[model samples]
Target: MIIKTLVHIPLYNKATTIVRTLNSVFDQNYKDFDILIINDGSTDESLELVKNINHHRIIIHSQENKGVSATRNNAILFARENNYKRIAFLDGDDFWCSNHLSTLCALFDKFPEAHIAATNYQLKRSRKTIDTVLSNFESTEDQLLKSFFHHNYLNSIFTCSTLMIKPEIVDKTGLFNESLTHFEDIDWFVRIGMKSKIAFSFRVTAVIDEIADNRSDQVEMKYRKLPDFTDYEAEAKNHLGLEKYIDLNRFAIALAYRMENDIRNTTLYQQKINLKNLSLKQQQLLKMSSLQLKSLKRTQKVLGNLGLHLRAGD
Candidate 1:
């Protein structure tokens, strides 16, 4: 039987949520898909749980702890060899809605020219759930690239879990950058946007759990490497003009430093850049002294205890 779509899931130590993630896939309305779960040396019960499932279409591959990028690349290679027509990604800890696959298939059928398609998603934060959709400014692929460069502080676009694309697009754009410990999805999306038209749907189709103690948070704490934006700077400038690229670079540098906990450098970069587009709290934080910033963090914790959460992204 011809596989219509190859669902690639990269599993780390996500035993707690792996079964729920798989259940979401198994419940999808679209049935012409095969599931590939790449176990990236998960020391937990993740692999055992995956094997306990009785689904014949599910295939689990085990390997030493290669990061997410390498695991995804392995799935891509498997899809290419097996002649899968389309590719979709779902991290083992996240899940999709019942109609997610059916909606994407319909979108591809509607827009034959679109090589990439993404659906909106819901973000499960600490206190409450928030729905996120692509901005109205991102109507076309070029516009999406522009919006992303200018205002992708939190990666508002559909993340890897909500994205589906044709295999030929992967052939043209290549695979995710293994060197990037973070922002690998953003880098891949930029490349894909440059090569083909990206289709967007406002329909919410996935749930992304963004709790504080996730694997990504742990990785960021242990391995602090700045994401390189130099590669896409020229392309961004060419597509969205020079000023926008400058703004994008400023934000990227500040974000990279912020991720590395270099508050001094983060504040310096934020100061040198424009602040009109940033949220009021973000601006205040950037201008605050180190001691003041620490006080604000304490205040944030207090607010959280009072059931009032303040997101930096606003």
Candidate 2:
């Protein structure tokens, strides 16, 4: 069958949650799509379980461990080489509601000029059992692009699992950066916003499965050495609100290092941000010493356990 929408999934040691994730795709209300699963050097039984599925609409491939950047870039190349018109992403540990694909298709139909369509998703944080979507804007093209960089990742408006893009976007925005440790999607989002019209829908149609035995969350932010968004300085200046977006990113990373007591790296990113771009609360915390920030973070963690959730990303 000619696949119009290629549902690309990348997997690595996701055996515990893989079946649930795949079933979410197989059960989509939108039917004109094909499944492409790339197993990236799993030490677990993820490969065997997938092989047992033996579904005709599903195509499976395996390779030695490469980071998510390589896996996603491979997915992009696969979509283009196979002549697929639209490509959607679903991480091996994430899931979709029945209407996830349908909603994306409808978004495209509603906005014919859109090269990208994204739906909001509920984040399932592991311990707190919190389920929420942090959407602060409407569906306008400008808002869709701005929603992503307007806040920190805790309040991010886009996830690969909720996005469907035309294959042509690859030519304009380029592949996902392999050098990025965790924010590869953020880097790609800026490029896509610069080159394409991003259409968005407020309806929630996906769940980010952090509650599962997720391997991706194993790494620490301090060890990863995230970028402070200086690379996009030129782009930030050209686009309205982009400078504040970059500043917020810098603040988030700097705060991460601050929480870890990595004073040198914290100062490195702190100097890169403009204090005016941050919220009053964030600005106040920025002035706190590393010890103060660590204590406050600990208090927040305790409160989270008690279900006294703060407004996310505030």
Candidate 3:
């Protein structure tokens, strides 16, 4: 049974949703794909569930807990080793729509020159759901890089589950930066966008389950240090280390302070940077942000301080 595409699901204690995630793949309308479950040091019943599944097409790799970047990198290598031409990613907690794989295969057939194709996602949280997709724009590398500087439109546009990429291109650009916790995908996408055009579909092909275990929220509460998220700040300081970017990070900290309505802390943070040095554009944006910060008031601060008791990233 030759595999045209390998769908990798990186799991880490996703006991609650692992079954649903795997089921989605098994239920796909497209059948040329194989499933590989990378157990990233999970201490839950996730492995037991995988063991119970009698599907020969499913492959499992159980190893000591490595971060998502390392696990994903291993997944890519696994796919390549199996002679797969295309690779796709689906988080253990997220599931793809039935047509998701079929659509991607068709798109690949039509656009052989495209190295990547990403679809929209349905963001689900509590009883609320929001559908997000990419807007019309030139998919050129330069255009995508310039767009990142303005805003992160790709967050909603391309999620882990909706992405399908050529194995060769991924090998050339290198794998996920295991050093990064947050923005790892963004960094990878930026590199990919630079190397080849990213074709996008407005169709909602995946459901991003935003449940109670968001990792980002845990980091914000000081419960744990998510190394990947820290890598961005570290790299900024180590590589570019531009004062402006540092200032931006500080400004973000200040915004966090403002969000908490800790005026004293906010002022202390503000003192670290020379307000006079801010570029006119940044200055204007900060000013507007400051006003919005005020509107959030003290109540929101209490809620944030209470903590996001659930999932970090959806």
Candidate 4:
């Protein structure tokens, strides 16, 4: 009666979307699985709604507000203790396509060497209504690690919702870094790609609802994880593509810091990036004050209104 898979869900104040997520899990074509829902101090009706479901296959764990990383680690720890062969992560606010587990599971069966697998996931932006592939995972680990190091806007692929990994891999690679409030998954993704074999599909099996909203100038940046790539820099010395990817990583970090109006840290990351990797305009934008950048964004929006769109990277 050993479950082959454990769907790890970290719940917060997601009463509205929790049911949708669980229903997707229930609708999966793959049935040899159990669910571990770790409610991370949700002050909403989320826990009660899940309690009412009364499904036998679901195991519930509730605790005070620990961030997503801690909750995810809890689920992995649970999976290890319960002897599950596979673990899939699904956030409270996200849901999966029915074939998600089946697709990932089949990858493991087909590629015995692959310790990690994921299906393509799409962004359902209510306003634009387009299916976008988040990550185009490469065939080789080197290619994957390179692609992973790049920002999501440019050929970004993996997501927690779409990913499935063998619990055994955690032993060699390690769990999510609890200290990182953001980019923890990417940090782990890099490590996984470096340490284990990863397999991915082009087929979409998860859906993330990105409610279209205005680009906030004053984006919050509390506890953002600054990924340390010092160790990888030596690896990049041999591969120029990897060198560009390292700069790209710095670019992404600088952008996040810029978004929070922290120019000092933004400059720190920007200083590490190769100026050639960025466009002339992007380079100039990086030097601008946050207020000036916000004004430029307003201008971009106005141009969009006139049917002239400008890419953020450009």
Query: Best candidate per lDDT, number?
Result: 2
What TM-score should be assigned to candidate 3?
Answer: 0.72
Q: After superposing candidate 1 on the true structure, give the runs of residues whose Cα lies further than 4 Å from its correct spot.
A: 137-155, 220-222, 241-283, 298-314
Give the whole-model CA lDDT for all candidates, comma-separated.
0.68, 0.73, 0.63, 0.70
Model 2 pairs whose backbones collide = none
Residue by residue across 1-314, what tens digits does model 3's lDDT show? 67789998888888888889899998899988888888888888889998899798888888897678788898888877879988889888888899899877777776677778777678775687755533335652312222222222223346677889888887556788776564456557545544565565666788877653533434542332222222234333333223333344344455555555557655555666556535454344344444575665632242232221122222
The numbered model that scores best in TM-score is 2
What lDDT score goes with residue 170 in model 2? 83
Model 1: colliding residue pairs = none
For 1-314, candidate 1 gives per-residue lDDT tens digits of 77879999998888888899999999999999999999999888989999889689898889998788888888888887899988889987778999999988888887878887778788776787776533335353322233433333433566788888887777788888877666566567667656666666778889877663345644432353434455555575455433343444455546445545677767665765656645455555455554654555543343233222222100
Measured on C-alpha atoms, candidate 2 has an lDDT of: 0.73
User: In candidate 1, how many Å is residue 227 off?
Assistant: 1.9
lDDT of 3 at 109: 77
What TM-score, computed on C-alpha atoms, does each candidate reach? Answer: 0.82, 0.87, 0.72, 0.83
The Cα RMSD in angstroms, rounded to one decimal, for candidate 2 relative to the true structure is: 4.2
Best of the two (3, 4) by TM-score: 4
Native-structure RMSD, model 4: 5.4
